[model samples]
Target chain A: MSNFDVIAMALKNLFKRKLRTFLTILGVIIGTASIVVMISLGLALNKNFDSQISQISDITLIHVVGVDQISSQSQGSKNKIKMDDSAVYNFKQIENVESVSPIINLSYAIKAISGKYSATLNLVGIDAQFLETLGYELESGRFLNDDDKLNIVCGGQVPYSFAKNTKRRFYFYDPNQQEKAPDIDVMKDRITISVDMDYGNIDTTGEKSTTSTAKAHPVKFVGVLKYDDFSYSPSDYNCYMTIEQVKKLKAEKQKFDKSSANNNSGFYSDNNSDGYNEIDIKCKDINSVKDIAEKVKDMGYNAYYAGEYLESMRSTAANMQALLGAIGAVSLFVAAIGIANTMVMSVYERTREIGIMKVIGASIYDIKKLFLVESSTIGFLGGIIGALFSLLISYLLNTTNISFFNNDSYIYMSSAAQKPLVSLVPLWLCIAAVVFSGLVGLLSGYFPARRATKLSALTAIKSE
Target chain B: MKNIIELSAIKKIYKMGSEKIVALNNINLNFEQNKIYCILGTSGSGKSTLLNLIAGLEKPSAGQILFKNMHIENFNEEQLAEFRKKYIGFVFQSYNLFPTMTALENVSLPLVFSRVPKKIRIKRAREMLKNVGLENRINHKPSQMSGGQQQRVSIARAFVNNPQVIFADEPTGNLDTKTTFEMMDLITGIARKNNQTLIIVTHDLEISDYADTIIHIRDGVVDEIKNKE
Candidate 1:
């Protein structure tokens, strides 16, 4: 028979028992929707984890805290590789290494003083040229130039860190974003950084030591930084200075503290020429982070980045997805049995009709094809509607606060992040669901259709 | 006239557990082209088995059946379907119309199997229905028609493909005398009009009156062969 004839007859037969057909199709619809939504949930979890990780740490940036001297291949070979100038040179030679910048803080001894207002913060000293690669967003003015001697770029929340007399701590409270305008007009005021912790302290005892207070240099407030939320931003409460500027301040402070023999306040007489304790290295991409970080570890350094954590998180999400997909597969399997049952019953009811057609000249192939087409049509319809239905379910899931699991477990570092979307559907998954359901229909109908083709024409026609 | 179908030394045996019941034995028959023929016998006389054997519904134990010199018994299931699609038609005792299909759709079934295009098949089915006096019942389903009308639709279905032979098995068994006479007249008139071979299996002597040749069988064997032409 012609294709049109077969298809038309199939559709007619299905409509003959509309309620049964609808129930079978409903089973398939539920099956397909469950599968798609379950997979989408797993995918969205991974996406959420990625965004959370990106907030706390740059996946492409690796921080080398210390050299692993004991674990090094050449343990006692030559000079030790530390997180210093020599290590920076060695790190640059590694392929895919974009840039390297050392991070140094003058031991919280530096205080920013603007008349009566002063703030004690971690006064970091970085190479002025490396500021561009450091991903700092300035709210006003410009970045420190290469020739800048004392130009300082204050952090986004530096103003809130300032207290009136440097005695009482200023604990600012902004739950989501702990950043706001400075209490003092830092941009316009004449500020100086002093190594003496008592630079702006109210001397309650009125006791004058033999040595005068350490010299405080005048500082230009070059710029203020934008308050991008601290959940992902790095060092939003610290201020920056050129490396030379911090060295000059700290060396002078060491000389004064050493001369005062009575003041053995744990100040180091050595110039720390060994190297800075921490170095930040940026890579070209997240994919290269693990490889270069591994090479640095082999060279005896504790190189760390988010890629390792991300890989583990991705695998966990994949495992969870497979589990969820298996759950959904059970639904489809049940629906397949429903289709098979319906088709078998249809074959039984149509035995006499099949015989009549055989006598009228229908081939066995035609008989089998007719039944398969009917069942597959049910499956295809169910799958298509199910895909669409899952989208609706996904929208409801994301919009409504349906927390399948707390993101606190999935987030890499930050605990204060907003909840991640719970469901995500890719285009291919929807298409696969439909095609797979149709294939399931064909497979389920196979036996019933075979039985139909095997019905004896003489006996079948003789039946009432 | 040339013979269209030939059956020689045909035998049909039905197995009842360990017992073998010989339904038809040592039967020989020939049907001519474009002639009305009948196989007449009483109930359980093996006439139906003989008809079934000739129709290729059941294989013979030791015989050869040929149609137009092509051995019908040798053809496999697929080739038999091909043969039937091109040459054979069937009308049943109960009409056997597809309950859901309209009268026109039922009539066009054979043509649909023959791979005739829809428009042309519908046209041929309409013409055949018109010949059977069912032109007004084109869209009526079998449940909506009387037994006579349903039989008329069945006759149209059998003849729609313009097949060379039509088989009517107890076509009047379910009809009243008036309706049965009308159905026979309509069926035979169309068969003769197309110059096609007709094979009717029935026990009624009156129903066999229209046939050009009648074969009488009793107790699994042909007892008489009469030619009225």
Candidate 2:
């Protein structure tokens, strides 16, 4: 018999027992939806972690560092150790270590028109070679240059300088007097800044027991800090100047301390004994960062890259994906069982009908295929529904009030240009959902179909 | 006359609790083409067993059954399916029409199994419905029709495929006296018009009046074979 006849007949039979068919299909629906939703959650987590990864560093960029081992039996003896200069030289020799530099951290003041902002300064004293390693783009000014005197670079969105504008507006007057005019921007243009500085040693415990014998430098105002509100980033109030200028101030301070120490030249202990305290090493690609860091650690220093943070973020996303996938898969399994039960019941109810078909020349294979087609159709419908529902749920949660961390206070709202918590479902996942549900239907219906086909025609005919 | 169905020394033994009961004994019978033959017997008299053997629904323990010289007893399930599709049509006492299908759809079932074109099958089914005086009831399901009317639809289905043989198992058993005669006339007329062999298994001897030949079966044995002029 033609396959259509089998399918048509099976469909008719299914329609006859509408509630039973639906209950059976519901099982498959639950199973399919669970699988789809689980996988979808996996995708969502994958996207979230991937975005967080970019926050640490551009995945394409790598970092390199220098180090030295303190002992022969140190933990990382497998790799060679080298000094900062030697490390820089070796990195330069490597074909893929694009650039390298030695850096030092020193404290400095960020001067503004109204006040001075003195925070713990991360004074990254880098040469022109190590500029790319910082991963910061300059918004309006140039980066550090070898020949350009007194020039410095900073992150593109850093708030180092502030600007103000003034405008005029009309003010209301008393009933007995003429209309008055005032410049509203004048009051707002006068910026005020309160500077909190931590000098030599202040006892935070005792109220008035702080002492400072050393002289404090009073900074002058050159510019105000600009506004930068990058999401999740702790703001840095910074000032930019040449590395030479900062070193000169340190040298003068060391000399003044020595002169005041009863003319003892060695008393200051040669403050700049270690010429380079920090370094930002840049490389050709991200894949090399972990290896380079290991090499640097062997040299007796802590080494890391922007890309390491990205790796952590990616791992976080992968874990979340697995969690969601598990949840979805459970439902799909339950649905398959439902489909199996429905087909079995159908076989029992249609025993006589099956016999009639057999007598009218329907083959055993024909009967089997008929039930299989009905089951496949149920799975197909469930898949389509589950896919659409998953997509809708993802969009709703991402756009509305749903938090994975259960922290309503820490909701990350999407601003005008930024995308909302990404609900990304791949095309392959949709296809998988459909095919998987269909296969579940097929498997669940197989045994029942066989049993129905094996029904002896004589007995089936005699059955009421 | 050519023998459309020939059964030689057929035996069907059944085990009932402790005793072995013979549903059909070693009996030989030949059913000719273009003739209506009836096997008349009471309940449990082996008439249905004889029909089943001829339809290839059951196999005899001894001897063989041949349809147009092809031994059906030797054919496998798949082969029997093919045989039924091309050459056999069956009508049951309870009017075994698929309740889900309309009368016309039930009649076209045999044609569908044979992979007949949709247009041609529907047309042939409609013509068969007309032949059985069920033209207006073509779209009604078996549940919507009376017992006699349902049997008529079943007869149309049996004749729709133009099979070599039509087997009716108590076709008029569920019908009233007036409806039984009407149904018998319709079935016999269609079988005669198609020049096909008709085998009717019935307990009602009155309904055998329409048949050209009658075979009396008693206690699994053939008692007599009578031919009317």
Candidate 3:
């Protein structure tokens, strides 16, 4: 018989017993909906975790520290690895490495003065070309460029670090009253940089040494960086300048210090000539971070990347998804059994009808196909309804502040303040649910359809 | 007259526990084309078994049954179903109409299985129901119709496909005397009008009188064959 006739007959048979068909389909609906909702919940949790982690650090950025520093701190090794311009050039040659920035933390003691507001500043010098690639968000103005002369970029908390010059106390933690942010705008203000000449000086003889005067240089404030509560780098409350400008200032300071000393004993340390203190490497892709970090470590540098932590987090999320999926599978397996039972009962009830059909020229294949179509129709219908119901459940879970997912006691403390969507069902998942349910129905109906085909026409016709 | 179906040395056996019961014993028969034949027997005489074996609904233990020079006894289930679709039709004693369908739909079922288009099958079914005097009740289901009317619908179904041979197993067994005569007349008239072979199995001798030839079956064997014309 034609496929159309088989389907028509199957539909007629199903509609003949409406309540039984509905009940069977309901089993499949519950199965599909539970599976979809459970998996979607796992996906949503993983997404929220990733966003929270991204707020703290750049997952793709790798910090390259001196191997000697790490070995010395950890194992009391005297060996030192120098981080200089050549180190930056070598790191940039690594495969999958996108960009590299050489950083110098200056040892010179300096202070920023804006009217009466003065504060000791932690200064860092870096290549101006890598300012954009460092992943720092600017609050205002622009970062330092190669052409900039004596221009500085300050961190968002730099103004708050200022204090009264006399008492030398931080404005952020004044004991007598609540501290306020200094009235100093880094983007529009002219900041005076005072170089303390007395810094790094110690008298060997038992004589009273006079403190030298501070040399003040007026520098244009360029930009302010965004504040990060959990920054992996020491960018907060620091002033950033180009390496060339910082080198010039250090050279001039060294020359003046040599002139004041009777002997040329006040020279800066020889190790400071190489300029950079550390190197930062940006990878082309987050997945390539681990390989690049390993290559850097092979070169005897200490490499730190967030890819390891991100990988562990992803593995945990995947395990959670699998557990949820397995739980859902159990319900679907039960629904499959229900479908098989319903199909077997249908075959039993339609024995006489099957006999009549056979005697009236219906082939065994046609009879079997009819039963298979009937059962699969139940599955297909149930899957459609189940997917739609899952969408509804997802929306309700996302929109409603359910106690279990949204409570303060939940593990995602960072995302707890803002309501995170607890459930998400994507498009591919809906399609997969329908197709999977239909396949399950087909598998469940196989034995029953076979039994239908094996029925004896002579005996079946005689059945009352 | 040319023979349409020939049966020789046909035997059917049923095993109940360890005992073997011979349902048909060495039955030899030849049914001619365009003729009405009746097999008359009492209950337990194996007339229905003979009919079933001839229809290829049951396989004989030993036989050489041929239809149009092809071996019917050796045909598989699928081949038998194909053969039945092309050459045979049946009217059961219980008027086994699908209760869910109308008379017209019941008549069109064989054609539907034969993969005929819906419009042509329905058109032919309506014509055949009209011929069976069920024109007004074409849309009426079997449960909604009287016993005789349901039987008429069953006869309409058998004739709708216009097969080469028609088998009626106790066609008038459940009808009143007047309705029985009407049913027999309607069935014989259709067969004769179309020159189709007809076989009837009945226990009533009165029903056998309507056939052109009568075979009396006794104790699983043919006792006598009488030709009226």
Best by lDDT: 1
lDDT of candidate 3 over A1-464, digit per residue (tens): 88999899889989999999999999999999999998998888777667656765688789886664554455434544457777788898988988898776654246566665666666677788777787898888888899987888877777667654443523353323214455666666667775553332334563323455446788888888886543323465678889787777666655665566533322234364554666888889888888889888866777787666667877887898899999999999999999999999988988998999888888898898998999899889889999999999999988886634333533333433467668989999999999999988888998999998899888889998
Per-residue lDDT tens digits for candidate 2, residues B1-229, read 9888888999999888999998998889998989999999989999998998889888888898988999999988888888888899898898899888899999998888888889999999999999889999999999999888899898888888898899999888788889988888888888888898888999887878888999999999999999988
Question: What DockQ does candidate 2 score?
Answer: 0.74
DockQ of predicted model 1 = 0.73
DockQ for all candidate structures vs. native? 0.73, 0.74, 0.69
Greater-TM-score candidate between 1 and 2: 1
Q: What are the lDDT scores of the predictions, listed in order? A: 0.83, 0.68, 0.82
- Which regions of candidate 2 deviate over 4 angstroms? A60-83, A107-121, A133-135, A160-277, A294-301, A306-316, A405-422, B16-19
lDDT of 2 at A336: 77
Model 1 spans with C-alpha error above 4 angstroms: A69-81, A105-110, A115-120, A159-173, A176-181, A194-217, A229-231, A244-275, A284-287, A409-419
DockQ of 3: 0.69
For B1-229, candidate 1 gives per-residue lDDT tens digits of 8999999998888899999999888988999999999989999999888877778777888788988999888888788778888898999998899999999999999888888999998999899899888889999999999988999999988888888999999999999998888888888998998899999999999999989999999989999999995
Q: Write candidate 2's Cα lDDT for A319-398 as tens digits.
A: 76777777777778778778877888888888998899899888787888998998887877777777777677767767
By DockQ rank, best first, the candidates go: 2, 1, 3
TM-score of 2: 0.82
- The better-scoring model by lDDT among 1 and 2 is 1
C-alpha RMSD of candidate 2: 7.9
Pairs that clash in candidate 3: none
